[model samples]
Target: MSAEPLVADHAHEVSDHGHDPHATTTGLSHIKLAMWVFLGSECLLFGGLISTYLLYKTRGNGRTLPTDVFDIPFTSVSSFVLLMSSLTMVLALSAVSRGEAEAGRTWLLATALLGGVFVGGQVYEFTAFVREGVAFTTNPASSAFFTLTGFHGVHVSLGIVMLMSLFVASVKGKLTQRNAETVEIVGLYWHFVDIVWIFIFTVIYLIPAD
Candidate 1:
């Protein structure tokens, strides 16, 4: 009945029942789970955009259709550049996983540069379209096309920003193997963006317009 004995008994009971609060029951990090959910939502968004583009692609009246204006060879080159960025992204993640911060930063910068190149090509294409009177208001097809592709460009630009931020973090000694999951998450996003472009290129560019 002594106070010291009661306190010691409570301490033992608590120690026996305690668990690690930071441990995940599913064996997956919360950040990764959240990223998967976000990617799922993005899939729905891109799906709707692609469907809209397909639905309205034939609605242009006396306006420039995709067949008339699409520069397939140029776009193919840009697509290849973006595709290569995915490779660099994987390399970045691998370097980070191995605690090679300098190499990871280099690969991240490479990926960002490739993404920038792709965006530059998109800008050029958009400029040429406007110059040729294929403005967003030209027709339904033009509107849908611009919206779909523009959204994708925005995603790529955001991805580039993230890559550059990661590079800076690596340079500052903030990124390491301990937090390599961050790089993996960003790589997931970058790969998703590239895959979406593949679909867009095939459905909007490679396929013939009716």
Candidate 2:
């Protein structure tokens, strides 16, 4: 019944929980948890935008129906590029996790390049749409369409900026495994953007306009 024996038993009990003494008590990294919360809020935001678009979609004047202006083939190619960027992002994360800094940076650059291509395609599409009388002020349908898709384009652009920043950090030796969690967090955002695009593409472009 010595106090020393009681203290030893308490220490053993604490260690039995398999908790890392140096890790956060919540068992998840704080940054990742924050990212999840941010993404969740984004889901609500995007959901509202999509609902608005769907509601106004059928309100377009005959001159600006989606079918008349949407370039499916061009969008298909852009979608493919964005989807492949997700793959490259995974590769980049894998490389970083494995401590292959050069390969990780290379893959990151590739991901960013592909994202750029997708954004460029979107810009071209938007310009073409404007030239064909699909301005944001043209009608309710056009406004909703521009708002929803423009928001997505801005997200992609921001993701590209993040990727480029990560690449620069990697080159500066600031992206070691000790802080590789940063890259993983950014990757999560990138993947989320790509997934959102999949939904948008299917809903806005692939389905036949009514």
Candidate 3:
């Protein structure tokens, strides 16, 4: 009986039906861990930036302040567009989860396009400000405003690159059963960018500066 059981175990191992109990972790699990660590560090970075912006928001010197220069209605629309892009990003992840690669790619492209539009709007707004005499070095208010919002734009641009890459990979069949987690990771990053914009919009546009 002992010999029979041993033979059965050996047969199972030889069959390809058994998994490796001691296999090393790879793929999505590793990606999630790295993202968690990166996000934690980013929290500190954004927190310090927010604190500095608030501290120097209104220096004693006359400055091109947010209150004076911000176009509330236009920025409000841009902010809404960014927030909606987060929804599209989630839908992209959902499409991947459902194994609908084409749908996922479509949604990813949409999200990236929306991000591009948002960034373009930001560029236009900045250019308008410059045209209206609000250079970054012209005042502490302008400096803080541009630094905080400009950093957020940089993040959005990075997210766009990641989204476009994912879309291309999906088209090429590189993203498959082995890589849906890549989509989830990108979704997390895209969502973070959207949430950060929410805070930036509130601080830079809605809040009353002292």
Q: Please write out the lDDT profile of model 3 over residues 1-210, one tens digit for every residue.
A: 113212232222332443543222341244577787898888888887887788877762675665577788989989989998999999989889888888888999999999999999999999988888787887777787789889989999999999999988999998774577788888998898787888878876788885
Q: List the residue pairs that clash in candidate 2.
A: none
Please tell me which model should have the higher lDDT, number 2 or number 3: 2
Instruction: Give lDDT per model, in order.
Output: 0.88, 0.86, 0.80
Candidate 2 vs. truth: CA RMSD?
Answer: 6.4
Candidate 1's residue-wise lDDT over 6-84, tens digit each? 2222222233334433344564566778899999999999999999989989888887865578899999999999999
Cα lDDT for residue 17, candidate 1? 38
Q: How many residue pairs clash in each candidate?
A: 0, 0, 0
Per-residue accuracy of model 2 over 26-127 as CA lDDT, tens digit each:
556666888999999999999999999988887877667555799999999999999999999999999999999999999999999999999999889999
Candidate 2 Cα lDDT to native = 0.86
* Superposed Cα deviation of residue 137, candidate 1 (Å): 0.8
The best candidate by lDDT is 1
List where candidate 1 sits over 4 angstroms from the true fold.
1-22
TM-score result, candidate 2: 0.88
Order of quality (lDDT): 1, 2, 3
**Runs in model 2 lying further than 4 Å from the true structure:** 1-22
Q: Cα RMSD to native, each candidate?
A: 7.1, 6.4, 6.8
